[model samples]
Target chain A: MIITNIETVPGRTIVEHYGIVQGSTVRAKHVGVDCVAGCQNTFGGELKGYSQLLEESRNEAMDRMIKQAQQLGANAIVNVRFGTSMITQGASEILAYGTAVRLE
Target chain B: MADFLFFVVFVTAVFFIGQHIQKKHFASLEAREQALLYLPAVVGRKVFNDDDVERAWLVHGTVVVSGDYFKMMLAGLIKFFGGRISAYESLLDRSRREALLRMKEAAASEGAHMVVNVRFETSKIDGGNPSQQTTGMFEMLTYGTAIRLKAQ
Candidate 1:
């Protein structure tokens, strides 16, 4: 499925808009990465563990959003947007939202 | 006396290591920013120029950075004084810029000439509240659509 944050996809036309479809997921890190991330804090560098976690969370959210688009009979999602919020002490929520559309 | 000695050692370590890391990060950002001078990325919600009419794809760059204990402690002390938490400023700056650079790199790899509608999302991963530990993590996600211009 084609997903672009732009209002319209390049080289394609939008025939119908299926309102807004969205997906969100909440995730918390494991203890091993938590300790490693803690140790990483001492040196003040990139926390690869947490970065990967966020990336995974983003992709999962996107996947669920795509499924919603599919259910709406849309082939693509346009004007996609991503959001992230700290849900709790150790957990975060990542959201993917967009306008599903049938392409011409 | 023992606790005092440990604080002294910890403060010294934070000073050396934290400052060193911060300096290195800025230096890298300086170089990378210069290298990415050609990519036409902007934060505007709408694309200003539409003449190219080429391919566009979604791209994202993510970065996570941790704060040193010294900065955390310094922020704590500043909180008591009701002043700005300047110690953590560099941490935010570093993560945000790094995330943007990564997004640029992703776009560049796709042979994209520019990125548009760029937006940044940030969140705290391992701090805040009484249940969590002392790990101070900030995550920045930069995402946009990379635009590849058609060859003339």
Candidate 2:
């Protein structure tokens, strides 16, 4: 399915709306990565592992949202937005949401 | 005594190296900003200056950056007093500009004349340490539709 954050897709016309759909995932760093990240906090630089963790979290959330849209028979999703929260000291929650619609 | 000395050395080394790297990154960003000045204007709204669109497609760019030790230290102090945190401001500024530049470059590479309906998203990834007040990484993401206006 076509996915975009813009209100309208460039070439597609919306035929039906499936309302709002959302997916979210919570992730926490493992002990080893947490140790590495602790070093990064002191040393001050890009934490590649944490970055990757967030990326994975976001992608999983997005995929789940897409799956929901597919189940709803949506051909496209628009106005997609992402939200994040620090669920706990060691955990982060990533949420992806959008309007599912049928495109012509 | 030996362990204390090693700790001092490690902090000093990281501080100096991080400074060097930041300086280099700032210089490079400045140069690239100048270079990207002529790229298409990217805005958040959907109104296109030229309506004769022959072709258009979505484009996106992302950048990940983190603060140095000095910056984090400054941020920590600012958090206590609670004023404008210029250290984090520069970090955000750099990330935003870098992401936009990457988007512009992507449009240019695709031979598009302009980009519209631009949107930006930011995410912070902090190390899972409760005691650490500073974020470990920040990501700036920008996306828009590149348009090719028909020749007049």
TM-score of chain B of each: 0.90, 0.81
TM-score of each: 0.92, 0.75
iRMSD for every model: 2.1, 3.7
Residue-level lDDT of model 1, residues B35-139, one tens digit each, is: 999997897645544556577789999998877777777777788879678777778888899999999999999898888889988877766432343646788
Model 2, B46-101: lDDT tens digits are 66543466666666666656776666766778899899998778667876877788
CAPRI-style grade of the A/B interface in model 1: medium
**lDDT assessment of candidate 1:** 0.85
Q: What is the C-alpha lDDT profile of model 1 across A5-98, one tens digit per residue? A: 9898877778999999999999988899888887777767788998998989999999999999999999999999988887887888899999
Q: Could you give the CAPRI-style class of model 2?
A: acceptable
Model 1, runs deviating above 4 Å: B45-51, B129-135
Residue range with the least summed lDDT across 10 consecutive positions in model 2 chain A: A38-47
Q: State the TM-score for model 2.
A: 0.75
